[model samples]
Target: MKKQDTLSPYIHFDRKDWAELRSSTPLTIDEDDIKELKGLNDELNIEEIVDIYLPISRLLHLHASATRELYESRNVFLQTNVKKVPYIIGIAGSVAVGKSTMARVLKALISKWPNHPKVDLLTTDGFLYPNEVLKERGLMEKKGFPESYDIAELLHILSDLKSGKGRVEAPVYSHITYNIVPSRTQVINRPDILIVEGINVLQPPKNGGGKEIDQISVSDFFDFSIYVDADEKTIFQWYIERFKLLRGTAFRNPQSYFKKYAHISDEEAFQVAESIWNRINKVNLRENILPTRHRADLILRKGEHHFVESIKMRKI
Candidate 1:
């Protein structure tokens, strides 16, 4: 029981009432028309997305339009400011927490909007340091950890995009290889809206004035940010289930880096999956990842079934 004089604001959105808060503006694209997204951890069907994500996309479309008008006005205000880049949106969350699904959902929904219909989705997995660098630094166990990434390169990409660099290239990662493939890159050419999603995209800036001072995080370039929220147990279960699924699917491919897991029995696979989660992913999630949740503009909280049950937006 605290005093009523506290200035802290209380705001909440009910899962049952999500429909009530939806923008009256009709959805230009039918949810049924949107393709189903297949992710390792979750299956987001068209209906679930239309009810939950379509409205959110509608909001973002409005946001992008308003932002463009403001940017044009500012550009005119400063004749010397010649180039204005795409509005960058950052989505961050723990492993197997459905951030990737959110990115896919938003990308599909936003692309249908009449304004800035061209939407591009990019993942920070491309920004990771090569496997050789991780092995050399003995950081193979800390792969998803912040230090495992080439922050400098990631920053350069974001900076270039924000500065209206018409042609941008991002490294491409092959899930089967579990590594960044050299000479294979994704091209982004003058995209109207860009979505950058990752686990540690929102990590705080480094304080040291060395090589890190110039390293701008993906979050620094984002105009809007979202952080998906869920309890540790739920996310842990999701991670395990996802790992099991991959063992039979992607892990069975001869070219897969995890192909070794295919030989293990179900019990052995489960143990191996839990071992990796306990050692690497869980540590990073609890220490370096979850701490950044407060930095998001909007937080989407999910329940045990992996369904988003509530939303918390930082009070303006």
Candidate 2:
């Protein structure tokens, strides 16, 4: 077992203890929903939902309720009427650590709440600079790094949503093409909640790469944030496993950007996946993603079998 973080500000909970917190939070989902919500190569059983994600849904719902009450109180004090914005949730983690799966699960669970039936999820991949733009900036190798994203645009979209914009558009990204689709966009109307998932959503201002920086940041818009974490070695193995699965599936598509990998021998696939992870994904995790883990409002630490072994919630 990994040693506890002695000086950490978070109140930690073991799986069994955390499971106890799910008291009376109705089990709104079942195995069928789990099979749909989980991502490729990820695991999600009914117990995990009852123990881990149910408590999480309960917490987020409570927080959102409190926030709405506070907003209404402010209106009473100021004697002015303003709209209540959607509660934004930021999910951050290294590649292949199962953050995406958790995001989907949370969105599904939270939407089951009566007051927050309309939930929307948006991933930051669409905010990445298009392949052409990255090629021009010589940042194709740094695709998931902070510098490779259009931070300004992401910030604008979040700002608009927070200001209660009725409709906002985010670009569409195609994993098959491995690039942003120029002609398509996702239109987000008013939602009771929004889940924004990405590797670096919790990142502080870089104040580098010749970019503009200020007191405000992407995370500032988040009412609650989560970081999915595991040991680097564990994450690396998961990445390789997911890559192999993709090679057999998505890579076989003629339009896949990685089609060449589809026919490669198993040994060759391992080497290529290893090289990509080492050169790009691992470096990004070490330097950019993992460093922001402490900034999260909660941390979900997964064990070797890809199950959340423990949780750490920031103390109030």
Candidate 3:
């Protein structure tokens, strides 16, 4: 493993050094709150929250404060009292690598600051194309890939949010149904802070028709972004474990799209999980997700048991 100082464009801190930075930041979240925030099969604990996530929340608060000051300054220069837009944060990582858990934890912690900014959490899963559309396009097997998302709609939603459009509506997705709920929507008012979490949140714009045209991606609106990272072997193991766990829980539900897996034996389930990882999730991670890690403002590198081993923050 490379030493902390050896990383370029980022200042790295090991677990101890990072924990020491959590000065005076009260751990506002309790055990019950943590239970509600953690994802299924995730190894998050209160100790990890106090040591790893508290300092991150403080840093995010500082960044949000700085952004507000800049916005005020710009408004003054323009001599117009424009409404301040929300500060957007993006979180990206591989499947089963715990990005959703980090996003929920950060949202909880950040909302407890003295300013008490109204924070909203959004996941890009809702922006994925409906199952019918994917099946019609013969892309059902590539569900989590970048192309499977309604990128234009996602861009429009983020663009509207950043432009101070109040009461914007986003589609709602159901894990059990494995599709968008047609009549359901999540209304996001003008929040002071918005956290968008997804696998492809850090992806850059792709070229179009061999023409060089300026394009804005969903990430372009992000004020700060984080990438949750871990070794591929660790992620693979976690993904398989989560698959098995879900089979015994969510997949057993009659409404679950994955209900077919519920009847499989543990050995059969393992084989199916391994096949999906090798065929879909692993390929998506290598070709789409991992390449964008360097674009993040901060990277949380996790070790065994999903504990944050080190943190890397990009230097200003």
Candidate 4:
């Protein structure tokens, strides 16, 4: 199937003609402009980003500003209505497609904006079901799948934030141990901007009657959303590289759950990685993740080398 015809929220980029499609909004930021958040690497430095991400940062700022005005107008129209607060942005992508890095970068950039100086970042990993629950359900292999997360908790938290609730507490996940530790909730107090980045944040609410209770989806709380997109082949390569890097770093820690994978041979590691990808991540991507691509406000399409080569914006 052609890239654009896919129903996913992301638009895939092949080596065609995209140079002319680069944004012409004249929104650019150099390294000196945002020295707060550490760049992922020298390759992701501001000079390499100004032409690509700067305009995106500006677009997000504009969207946030407009959303604030919209709420104010509605609040005025309904005299009894308290102001709906906090512009929420959801960032979704595969595990190693650099969504976390993008979210952190945006958090830093957006917080610097005068309109919303109190931006916060949250990850859905924190909401995953406890290890005991997963084991009881025989779903250890489906860890990153939507079923692995505590959907009820996630939904409730998002609902509270959308209703302008103050001082929301979210649990923290340890990447080193790959588990939800205890009592480590992060408090987000009256944030102007909330960026929720997760693998399945865009999944639709389950339908049907009877035992299933209908509820609002997490995507319903988003004012704007971004999907970091790239080809599956490229993402696989990136994931393998990331896994290899983590082995020497986080995976070697005594408290890490993936310690078993730390000492595997390169060939064995590749097999394990491919096994996890093919059976788990790829299934989630094809079934749940990719189908939600069209839901994104902006799709940042990356090239073979992992740099965002083009962007597709949903028509207003």
Model 3 off-target regions past 4 Å?
Answer: 1-7, 209-214
- Candidate order by decreasing TM-score: 3, 2, 1, 4
Better model by TM-score: candidate 1 vs candidate 2: 2
Among all windows of 10 consecutive residues in model 2, the one with the lowest summed lDDT is 206-215
Off by over 4 Å in 4: 1-43, 81-84, 209-213
TM-score of each model, paired residue for residue: 0.92, 0.96, 0.96, 0.87
What tens-digit string does per-residue lDDT give for candidate 1 at 1-316?
1112235332456665554555564555454544455476675655556556755676677677788888888888886565758878899999999998889778876776655467889999988888998999999999999989888888888888888799889999888999999999999988888999999988988766466545456688898888988999889889888888887799889999999997788788779988999999999999999999889887888888777877766565
Alpha-carbon local distance difference test for all models: 0.80, 0.91, 0.91, 0.76
| TM-score-better candidate, 3 vs 4 | 3
Candidate 4, 12-42: lDDT as tens digits: 4432333333355333345655454433321
Candidate 2 per-residue C-alpha lDDT over 226-246 given as tens digits, one digit per residue, 9 for 90 to 100: 999999999989998988899
Q: Residue 173 deviation, candidate 1, in Å?
A: 1.0
Please state the error at residue 185 of candidate 4 in Å: 0.6
Q: Is candidate 1 or candidate 3 better by TM-score?
A: 3
lDDT of 3 by residue, 1-316 (tens): 2234554888888888888888999999999998899999898888999889988998999999999999899889999787768999999999999999999999999889998999999999999999999999999999999889998888888888877788799999999989999989999999999999999999898756343323667789999999999999999999989999998899999999999999898899889999999999999999999999999999999996999999888988
